[model samples]
Target: MSPHFPSMAEPGGRTLGDEEVAAAERVIRSGMLSAVWGTEARALEREMAELYGRRHAIACSSGTAALHLAVVAAAPDPGDEIITTPITDFGTVAPILAQNAVPVFADVDPETGNLDPAAVARLIGPRTRAIMAVHLFGAPAPVDELRALADEHGLVLLEDCAQAWLTELPPLPPRPATPLAAVPRPAAPLAAAPPGDAGVRLAGTAGAVGCFSLQQWKHVTCGDGGLVITDDDALARTMRLFSDKGWDRAAGRSHASFGLNYRMTELQAAVARAQLAKLPGVVEARRRTAVRLLEELGGLDGVRLPRPEGHAWWLFPLVLPGGGAREMAAALAGEGIPARAGYLEQPLNRAPVWSGPVYGTSRFPLDGADAGRGPTAACPEAERLVADTLLVIDWNENYTDAHVTAVADAIRKYRPRP
Candidate 1:
């Protein structure tokens, strides 16, 4: 008998359901299908903003567009430098080049696969304008320390929350003053807030702005959409104009500043709004599924399960013990399991396009070279993960216990020799 189970083969084909279909149809029936500001779009922005505890939210066509708008709103000038991790999708780095700003690659912590705030602090220099930290694989980064580094350097902090929506940072106790400490603590004890409330701050809220993706595989699917959340009113307005092709909301007209047509469609917004209603449930389901899988796969000599988090699970990425990511993915695919590499592609720093003459101009030196020389050094950690991480795609709210067992059984059955 074949060991394959139907549930494990395809996890995310489940669509929005009858109510969502009805909502989308109503929008289509209204004869307003384009990117004009409408009820559906506005409602999604409002609800998403409330979810992240931000003052404003702007929806765009894709996560890449959200990053572009955020970068443009934050930098707004050529030759500015933004420090970002090399382990992310090119979409994160594309916005830096789109604005003609230089991207300084920062290595990630091998354990968390997130940006190292210490590396970011070390990279800060005179031209540093912002630090964009990616919360890789649904785990939150060290937000408090990153914010402190950003504040000390007087630079903007941007969060790539595409993978980590609604994820909260761990509580950090207040540091005690030492003999040479610059500041001392107050004498009176502060009133305790709520229990969970004591340490919780949403991922993007810690930075100057946060961007989220509502793509097909994300926890909340909008087919293809993104949102930018920020407490800065001016930055919010700037993003609105940038996303709407330079239309100034205050003046109610198109402005001279260059912008793009990155607005999300009304239909997408309507579908997303419906999905938003189910987001908390979906996130909880993903978390439970991840826990079950981790338990089943525990004690494996070479494989590493993603650390469980308090929020949504976007992707369940496993690191092979011996570093043969491609080999493991191919082996799993042969067994009718839909496993693949960790990301859509490798890091942007190693892409040939980045090394080409187009981006090698004096304005943007390729690794500080006068000519278009290759990257100064290979991003070994990024390369290792790219070469060795196997990704189980599109974790859904419908995973059963049998499905988890099947996955663990397969991994155990096919133990690769070191």
Candidate 2:
């Protein structure tokens, strides 16, 4: 009989322990459940900010809220464009629409399913206001190149790190040899970076603001929560205000600007704090097991394994270049290995949302725009990835060496034959 594979949905797969329980009790006993009046959420913010080496971290209701906050910081006018990949959670694109901006779908790298920088460069135009990049399945996006484009075009760059907790990024490339005048100035100079940041470049620190998720399935969980980190004081202040219904606590009961009630509660914050404490161990274990599986499946044909460098291993993805993901997933599932073909039924460019009215029977900003035509034609690589090439296996920190072996055996058996 095969051993049971642990999953993120259950306690066995999660790192939750007595620590999380005690945190909940502490918050309950304090009689303060609201973040606005509680210390727990504020403390969580401080810890997250410090962990990411950012000047500020604002805790919010969900990952979508965090992305929404970043969009708010961009302050897009109606119909302004924000380019992003189609291979990510809708949460990454919803925020653009929520802020009345048009999302321009950019094609992804065929292998990694991350936004292709060259594709993004092609889409940038007069009305382009920002670029939102997702580090898909914890593989680092090429933020250094994306940042360069943002700087050149005076665009805001937002990193969606929901699936990328502790995902390390490559070091910045050496300075270009171009003349100073030829290099465009950034929209705003980044503030002084935090101390001791020269060692590791984590996923969230490369852009203007990095958004993280604390949803139930994330590396850490508080049921549903999020945090956005940034070094810019102005961006930090804007996000803080937006998360709290634009209320300025410093100004006596006065409303400051447009916003929402996206604040994280004390209970959620407390639980997340406990989970955060265990995050390093969680990520390390995941890396260890994922790398082991990579080794086991090293020389396979007709499929490409994800490169382990700086990957958090959210889901172990395989790209069957010859196109048999569906069959391979079915084979793995038959052997009791949890796997799925196509992360989504279809990429976001072809999502059903695009076929319907976005706002109460009105498309508004989408009307008379390239978006109305649907960007499906614009991102062939992303479309093919979702419909044919991609496969993802459920992964978590609790996976053992035996589990990795089981997965490798099944994949080796089912991999397309020449």
Candidate 3:
């Protein structure tokens, strides 16, 4: 049991305070809570779109909804295959299934825990239609190569940047003839392999479309909101309709294709705008603490930090040897710091629900009523990733240097505990 720390009682109320309250009050006073008109949601969308350098941005109810809209926007045919990494939240894969598309599990780079382009190449087949690269734990994957691969095969490249917000990473590396084969990458999620920089690039800006989460745990929170960014005007228009149940507000109740009601409310939008304003400072605080920790622990024999430029430091992940991450987590917990031994309970491929029938005996994608589940041996490298290392720390923008030092000292005090 951890004792209460002085930092725990800073009176930060969910990143909301007088500022957000004032914004909400203004929205309420306007009497237009819907996003259809020139309201808070619309303004938030405009600001977000411009912020990311995207021509259009669509606000939705959740990050999962944003992904679903992206799938629909791509217009994937039934039974089409989308290659993605398994080391992610269920939201990442659920969209493919919702669109009646098959999710082809691809191996990930052990160091960054990102989709390995070569592994994705191996999985590409006749049914392949798209590839999704998740910036796992806020580190940039090999986006240029993935984009090139998608272009070569006429595939749509979608980026899932849930943990990555404002992550300016390395420039595109030289295109490899083939992506290197995946090996046993220990704590690839925590210890990213540094990609030499040619210049700087943002995480979600690399692909044809990028999805981001603003859930409570993310870099910024609108309580629970999501944003989608894209340069294609027509595609953006289609996404707007998809998010609003196929109704074109500009056309006055005109209907287009079938869609869903995934609109972000004015209240959420109001708070989102406020949060966005504070994001630069939020990011800088985490960056400073993360950098200090790196300097303190980087040379500790078994410790390593992520590539400086590419990592957003969403989680201050550390790769530890042996199987003592659980002990480390417990010890940190005792000191009032949070830690986790592994990223997920299990890789998505091995999840029980994924192996079962969907929509009551319909498994067109995974098992097709025959196997009723996808292949278990898929994404072997992903399996090794979680089993091998520990995420020694979790990050928040409010954490100060003292908090970071406490984390480092705790880890140093205990390691490879038998």
Taking all chains together, each candidate's TM-score versus the true structure is: 0.86, 0.94, 0.88
TM-score of 3: 0.88
For model 2, residues 124-221, the per-residue Cα lDDT tens digits are: 98889999999999999999899999999999999999999999999766776998789887889876565444668899999999999999888889
Would you list the clashing residue pairs of candidate 3?
none
RMSD of each: 4.6, 3.8, 8.4
Sorting all predicted structures by lDDT, with the top scorer first, yields 2, 3, 1
Clash totals, every prediction: 0, 0, 0
The positional error of residue 374 in candidate 1, measured at the CA in angstroms, is 9.0
Clashes of 2: 0
Candidate 3, poorest ten consecutive residues by summed lDDT = 1-10
Stretches > 4 Å off in candidate 2? 174-198, 371-377
Model 2 clash pairs?
none
User: What is the lDDT, from 0 to 100, of the residue 161 in candidate 3?
Assistant: 85
- A best-first ranking of the candidates according to their TM-score comes to 2, 3, 1
